[model samples]
Target: MSEQATTTPTDDEQRGASTLELFFDLVFVFTITQFTHAFGHEPTWKSAGTIALLFAVIWWMYSGYVWLTNEVAPSTPARRTVLVVGMFGFFTLALAVPDAVHGHGVVFGWAFLGVTLVHAVLFRVSGGDDASAAILRILPTNLAAAICMVIGGYAHGSATYLWWVGALLVIGVSPLLSTARGFVLRTKHFCERHALVLIIAIGESIIGVGTGLAEETMNLQFFVQVLLGLTVIYVMWWSFFGNDNEHGEAALDDLPMTDRTRTALIAYGYCFVPMLLGIVFAAAGLGMAIGQGERQASWAAATALSGGVALYLAGQALFRAALGLPRPWMRLLAAILAVLTTALGVYVAEWVQLAAIAVVVYGAIIVDDVIGLRAGERSSYLAG
Candidate 1:
């Protein structure tokens, strides 16, 4: 093992997230709240699209910093300074979220740029020490991205906005892209913990639905909406905390130290793509069920819930493939689609849409549980 790797906390040393990391995560709660509120106003396909893209932007920005703290261990003095400055920059970005694409985009740009520069300087300063080689690997691309981000902010009025911003983000993440194979110090444990954090974040979708329902009405319809929201949460718990997590960790355990960390990073890092998509769709689905488009509620909301489930399962598939696990995510995907189909039938028959979605979700859980039981039985039989 490298001296650096040995000196760093082992998986046993850091049991999940640190207290400070959790505090940093609270910042994102603001970001998510802003996202839901902003999207809530539009509540259309376009809004959904915007929210999805925004998730990529936000998650990439956030995870990169987390990765740095891991490789560099910035909780110390000089590193602490970088983190504090970055925090100020992040705060600005959070404050600008209410109008990122429109009114207050400049604030967003300035904040992101500040963070970018802060990150770059930290890399430059730490060069050749404390994984500085890894740091340099990302610095140039990130700097280019930061410059373009600011320029894109200035050009939001034209056709150039899409191309500029898209290109910028591409450059920003190119190093972290699959090619260089990511940082050496990258740990799967770090990534998995973050992945769980995201699942917990997605659980917030249920809250969004509940908050929406609590606004101004009460009836069988209202109660059904609440029940459906809860059901979606149940499904997330069932699907994610199922065998995939255990198998994923076991797969990591099977690898060499560096290999384990790298695999974990790739598997966990990429999960943000599908997870954020799923979570956002879930939120949108909830939005559909409460007060807007009463006629379309059944189909639209069901679609959102189903889409979210699909994304989550798909992410798991990719993650499992990376981890060399069997195709466990497939069953989850099948269950999701099955429920969605049943939901459609319920809608056409004019039953309460939310109630229908709830039943479908519970059915999926039951199916997975049965599969688990059968698998256990087979194992026991083999043992005997």
Candidate 2:
């Protein structure tokens, strides 16, 4: 590739995410909405497994684009066109999600293949030599995964599941098969891009509250549920955006290129799967709990609520560990407590269970702050 075709910004020229990138992320928010709505409508183990499978495949490529834009921004008209095409692919894929495991598998597979192709072509044409070489090394496996998706689309019956699982394995193992030493990590943009996606996904929880409220009569109970739901969402946001982003950025910036690349794959690429899944399940669960103050929560709804929060806290713990940050003992304890609330949901009123989860999460944050204060360390929760 010609040097001029490469869009990798120099270290001195590093920047945050661009407007086009933010717009691109808006397309992904639609996918998040689809997943949340689907799960909310049918909060079953089967549905949850299907959503997980789809998310694993979709998130892998979405994260790949984040890496792509970090190194090769769409500053040029040509690059912008390619990215917009990729956005269309994501939009189409979102449309297919509600029925992906059933009737829309073909459409989902084709949309995914298109997205994968766009990522490869854009990176090869616009990335720096090292990045170009890196994408080239992994291109065959990527294509193989995409082709598996296509074959999975054409599949039917129980056989379809096998094909899709095979596709996930192919892509999931791609990082192990290929090396990341050739790619660059633009730390600021990389961190900001991930933070933006996460915050947008978090918004789905608010949307869930709104969705539940839409069917209920406005009353004292309505106001109470709204407050409790917002509290849970707000606490979740604080848990991540508070200081984890800064810690993550600092950790990556401190590493050598090869180590940084591997950490990014593990931290951002792998750990984020559970974090995002937690948001989806939490949103679905919260939607089910809202306006049902006196009724006992169904098993699926209860598990979705408590288990979802536990998953998020656990994912956060893992994210911190991956970056070599101190262990999040308080959050880990909170995750355990969150899981224990499943019984509370099944027996007590849904509102009570919701309240317990909120207390556990917010209380953990407060305790974490107290521990930091006692140790004479700057509190991570208080720091910007």
Candidate 3:
């Protein structure tokens, strides 16, 4: 527990993000904001799908960097310098995200490639059998993504989009196929960081919901609606950060190197599906608050809230499944809650009623903490 004893992360310690690493999240915030703007400009199902896919593709790149940094952070001074430069690459890529879909999109493509080059170079310089081995696992995938982005820049239209999307599917998956066993430090750090970053993202949704409600005219009516928004935020808070999350993180932290990496790769790494779902939920709630609630809102808004709740539950289910526990009631309840609220939001009259429906769904999410969260809390899982 002493400071000296904590000098270097061991094979067991969970390595969440450092403060500096957290600052890196600012880039992704821009990425998410860019997607939101793009969606607003052309709010079609296709646009939504495209935006989600693109956001996901960029997120994967960030994930790879985090995974590697968690394991080993450029141990020597020279390598560390390259990493600092890579940070700039991340910022450049983020700045270009808004234009990544078109127009001189090569800025994004080049920025993304530059970041990958940093990782590839890091692998070469780590000078250890283990430190650099996992790099190869991701090399092909990263290269594929890099190539697709760069090529798509010139190709334009559906051909370009399809090319990038295909590349993302392949790139997103290749690292999991990595049978490399030497990435203990990298995997452990990545898993722990995921727990925290996941929280950060969830936190952003809470902020979005609050700010959304706050932007509405504050009167007795708005007061009640704000309370309703806060309540939903509370529900989301409990579902993601309560005992279930703690237990799941503990389970992952204790996993063997390969399992730990796998848990992070496909299962844990995949938790962002819910995180984005949650954000969209908040955005829908925000939209409803800002008087975009004509037609009593729509199926989409309702689905956003409900789907978010479901994704939160599904994340827990996947986490437990990875940790060897298989209870699925939370996920089931989450899906049910989502369906209920979505239906109610679409059918209800008045903003107050929508708020009321959200409350009911959120209340269910809170109750799950008491009932369904027990199995996870009592489980023998805890990442090292």
The C-alpha stretches of model 2 lying farther than 4 A from their native spots are: 1-13, 374-384
* Per-model TM-score versus the true fold: 0.80, 0.96, 0.82
How far does residue 315 in candidate 2 sit from its true spot (Å)?
Answer: 0.8
- Model 1 agreement with the true structure over 1-384: per-residue lDDT tens digits: 112332443434344555556656666655676676666566567666666665666666677766665555554567666777887777777788767767776677778778877776665565235445666766766666666667666765654357445744675457456334334343444655575567557666666766666565677765655665666666665565655666566666667665765565567666656766676665766666554324544554556656666676667667768888665556456546634653652354222444555566556555755665677622221232
Angstrom error of the Cα, residue 30, model 3: value is 3.4
- Give candidate 3's error at residue 77 in angstroms: 5.6
Model 1 residue runs over 4 Å out of place are 1-15, 122-130, 158-160, 168-173, 176-182, 186-189, 290-295, 298-302, 328-332, 335-351, 376-384
Candidate 1 — worst ten consecutive residues by lDDT sum?
Answer: 1-10
Candidate 2 minimal-lDDT segment of 10 residues = 1-10
lDDT of 3: 0.61
Estimate the TM-score for candidate 1.
0.80
After aligning candidate 2 to the native by TM-score, how far in Å is the CA of 97 from where it should be?
A: 0.3
Off by over 4 Å in 3: 1-16, 74-81, 185-188, 206-215, 288-295, 350-357, 372-384
Rank order by lDDT, top first? 2, 3, 1
Best by TM-score: 2
Give lDDT: candidate 1, residue 212. 68
Q: Supply the TM-score for candidate 2.
A: 0.96
lDDT of 2: 0.85
